[model samples]
Target: MDRPGLADFLRRRRELLRPTDVGVAEGPRRRTPGLRREEVAMLAGVSTDHYTRLEQSRGSAPSESVVAALARALRCTVDERDHLFHLAGLSPPPRRAARHVSPGLLGVAGRLVDVPVAICSDISEVVWTNTLFSALMGDVGTRPGRASNITWRWFTEPGVRDRAPEEERDRLAAAHVSDLRATYSRRAGDSDVTELVDDLLQRSREFRVLWERHEVAVRRSDHKTFVHPEVGAVELRCEVLLTPEADIKLLAYFPLEGTDAARKLDVLRVIGTQTFATA
Candidate 1:
């Protein structure tokens, strides 16, 4: 937990992402290049000071639509989008436990073995990931208890920072945790969720503050940019499909307009296969 309050959360998340992450180009002399709060406000259609309050914890809960807009401006992932709601104290409708994946979705993922792909739970747990995902993310997804989690390594481990353009990785991790806090607020007494909350809260500080904001979001979807160690610069269009009959979600990735991301993905395919074979 790196971000404790709105101020820290805003500052931290901004630090982690590069200007390119928010669709801004790397400026000539920007020591740090993520979108400023004012810039983000313009994109999100909110007043600059108002948006600043949301980040600084001066303003209270944001409307659902506003949260969604900000998430889009940030190019958040489904997990991140959901987090936006949680931070705003909104509840998305819940579904049953065992959701089904569409054949079309699986087919699409299967066809993109070159790029990392995964199906995640509403809570950001990685339920299933393709071989390339396992290859790119190392063995985390392959491990029994480590699957379906986004912030585990991103927040707690140091190595992950090298893989993304974010300078505030810890802050973003905290934001996710804060989002989870808002989510679990709805099911506060559930043992499993409670335990997870306790674990993360004990493990990180940023989580504690964002959680206090009591934010929550129900909808999902977004774009993501990652600086893969192997793939120098990569942008991905991330989409989340809600499965019928359950709460499960399928998250998939595809390359952005122009980049060498595809070439790096090929390297990941080879690396993942080689790693798994040796294992």
Candidate 2:
């Protein structure tokens, strides 16, 4: 690994970004040229000391997860992200269809403060989520391994389906199954997709029935009702923004204007973040 080069690249990238670019406040006193080390560490999901050591060229090689997080935090382009991986003595992710979130998309997600936003992979795995999303969806990032996937949770975990309305549960389950089918067609031999499908077919009769239908449907704009324990029921319009590669999608939830859902969302924002059981 080129330690000095990596340190230089990281420092330069950090200096290029401003507070406003990443949805952070500038504050009153203006001394620093760009975002602070702590701010980047927070955005990248790493310890401040670790990031500092990397900048100082005194840290060990970062893992793929940390490199990906740093790429997102630095808002690096595809080429820059690849360069970061190479500098850390790791192979860059394949250029073909894969499940990875883009740095630009991550930057966009960070800018959305009022709404609950999450980035999901092609197979419906929750790659990243903002704070509001954690409050609404029970901290999906904390789920174990494949459980972080929506389809996996919907089939294997009973509590996950409990959040949706009873009347709509069947339809939601069908939709999730159909979406997984679409992904399975694109990523036929992928281990994650294959294992998830096999596990679901073994564990869930409902999923097995839906999978047999061979339904293929992409997600679109729709209204979803979620039952939050603290805020009760909230109905929000779900919108999806696909990245250029089409492997990652940004899912944002917005409450209708002048509605009780909007008020409930406000209550959630005021409540801040809280821990909830993960499936």
Candidate 3:
């Protein structure tokens, strides 16, 4: 995966970035030229040994913050930061990538039920989720093919109507895809990413066509509505949170203020629990 080359490249890149470029003064007798290992390490707030290990590709993975510090030390651009992360097997910080899910993260998703909560990692893989989220979408998790992914399901599956009737479905689907696209742009070469695109192209003409437009979107604010067969219509506000370390997105769905969506959600929770117990 170019780990060694990437590490070497990063190290050389850092060394090549002179103090002048980073707005630091060039000290006397720079024998090797470029910033000293000590200088780069100091700026990155890491031990010289650690930085050396990273350059040699002989170290454990670095934290996102540490990587960010290193990126700054090397004067990496945004694309470079993301590329560095990809080489290191990390998602870019909560801003541009999807992250793996942990128990604590699942707990947060479970607790925040007034909204649908799902966690996706880089390349739009659905790693973990809460019950209310699955229930609202009407067996989305059980659907064939890419239906397991919100973006995939929305764009590539024919099951949207079962989850939400016409008008509401399109809005939610569009917003979700837009958010997914924003994340995808930073790491376009991930294999799963290519698979998703291929599947969509082959399975859904709409996604195939939209894929051509190359419209990118970030997970900004959006309004979503779902017409649940059991709960009638529900309107929600969407918020996306990027997790530290892994660029995972925590997407939450909140009901519109003072809406009956709250009670509907309660019912969904009960239903979800029952379903889980049975399965």
Clashes of each: 23, 0, 7
List model 3 lDDT by residue over 1-279, tens digit each: 456966787777876777765445677777766787877887566789888888787877777656765775676666777787887778776444342244345456646645677666655555445557778864443333355576776665565556565766656656565655765676577666667767767887777666677677776456777777666788788777776644676778888887887888878877763433223
* Model 1 ranges off by over 4 Å: 1-114, 146-148, 168-171, 185-188, 244-246, 270-279
Candidate 1, residues 103-219, lDDT tens digits: the string is: 345455556545677766546666456666666665444344433367555555667667665764644554566656655765667655677777767876766666666667543
Report lDDT (CA) for all predictions: 0.58, 0.83, 0.66
Provide TM-scores for the models.
0.53, 0.88, 0.55
Ranking by TM-score: 2, 3, 1
For model 2 the TM-score comes to 0.88
Best by lDDT: 2
The lDDT of model 2 is 0.83
Worst 10 residues of 2 by lDDT: 95-104
Report the lDDT tens digits of candidate 2 across residue range 145-195. Answer: 687788888888898877899998989998898878887897789787898
Ranking by lDDT: 2, 3, 1
